[model samples]
Target: MSEGGIPTIDIEDFPAQMGKLREACEKWGCFRLVNHKIPLTLMSWIEMGVECREIIKVYAKAVHGVGMEIAGKLAESLGIISSSGESEEIFRDWACQFRINKYNFTPETVGLSGVQMHTDSGFLTILQDDENNGGLEVMDNSTGEFLSVEPLPGSLVVNLGDMAAVWSNGRVSNVKHRVQCKKGEVRASIASFVLGPKERVEAPTQLVDSEHPRYMRL
Candidate 1:
C-alpha cells in the first residue's frame, strides 16, 4: 500500500496478486491496477480467454471491458464466485454506462470545483485519468479528510461505489471524492461504471453471518 493506504496491484504477481486483490478489497475498498498492458507473448492465451488488444484499440470500449473484468475479479477475490463456476450472471443484462469528461479550468474559475463531491452509485468504477493534468481527490473516511489521487502514467484507479459497500455488508470502503480546478489545461478522464442489477443487490451468503451481519436491504 502507498502512504495513503491505497494499494497498487501488479498483474504479473499471479496467485500473490489474487491475495493482494482480496486484501485491498477487504481493507482499502479500492486499489490502483498497474501492469495492465498485456505482454506481446500472451496473445495465444488471451485469444482463448478475454479478447486481446486488437479489440481494445477503441479506448471507450476498452475501458468498459476492463471495468467489467475488474468487477468480476473482485467478486472472485471475495469468494462471491468460483473459478470453475460460470461467470456471475447478475451483470449480464444489467444497465451499464461509460463517460468521458474534459475539464478546462480557466484563471477566472480557479479554486472552483470541477466536480462536486459525491460517491458513485454503482458497484465499481475504473477510471483512466489524464497523465499531465491533475485535479482529482478521494476522501479518506478514516481521517475524515480528502486526499489527492495522483496516479502514475499508464495506471488506472479503481473505486468501490455505494452498491459495493452494501454488498460487502459495509466491509469495503466507499470513498467520497471530487475534482478541483487546478490548471487552465484541459484534464481528460474516462470512467466506466459496472452497475448492480436493477432488481436487487445484496451481500453474498458467505459475507453475512453472526460476525458480519447483513447491512443492506436488497
Candidate 2:
C-alpha cells in the first residue's frame, strides 16, 4: 500500500480483477482491488467531481417518486421485462444522491465519522479511496465478521448491490460494508453506482436448472 493505503493494480490485469469480481459477487458480495488505473489526477479534479455530482443529482430528481419510469428503462437496457410489478419501487429507491467523502485531521477539523454498515441501492458500485489512509471494512456474511481493507493506490474497489442480488435470484450477494476513521490520518474516497435504465422489468432470471437457478437477471 502507498502512503494513503491506496493499492494500485495494472489495467493489464483486468482479467484477474474480473475473476475477483466474480468471486465477490458469488460469495462475499464485496472485494478490495489493487491497480485498477483510474488516475489520481482525474480522481482529485474538482471540476470533474462537480460534473459527476450534477449528473447524479439530475438522475435522482428525475426518478424521485416515479420508480416505474426508471424500472422500465432498466428492463429495456437489460433486456428484461418492461414492468417491475411490486419491485418497481425498489429500483426507484436505488436511484439516490451521489456521495463523496474526504477526510482530514487537524485541531480544527477532526476526521469524519465513516458511514454505517449498509447495502447500496443499485446493482454495482466502484469506489476509489485515498491511497494513504485506511478506512474501509466489509462484513463476511458467511463468517459473520468484518474485515479491514487498506486502500491501495491506483486501485478501485467494486461491489455488487442489493438490486443485483435480487436480480440474480440470490446467487449474487450484496455485502454489507462500512468505513471507520483512522485515528490520525486523513482520507478521501469517490464512489459511483450503476443504475438500471427506465422502464425495465426487475427480476431474477433462470440461469440453471431447478436445483441451481441463477440468483437474479441483469
For model 1, residues 70-133, the per-residue Cα lDDT tens digits are 7667667777787413344645665677666778678877778999988888888887777677
lDDT of 2 by residue, 80-125 (tens): 5433344464454454434566766443433454677898877767
| Model 2 TM-score, 2 decimals | 0.61
Residue 153 lDDT in candidate 2: 61
Ten consecutive residues with minimal summed lDDT in candidate 1? Answer: 41-50
> Candidate 2 — which residues are off by over 4 angstroms?
1-20, 34-37, 44-98, 103-113, 184-186, 212-218
Off by over 4 Å in 1: 1-5, 38-57, 88-90
RMSD of 1: 6.2
TM-score of each: 0.81, 0.61
In order of listing, the candidates' clash counts read 0, 38
- Candidate 2: C-alpha RMSD to true structure equals 8.5
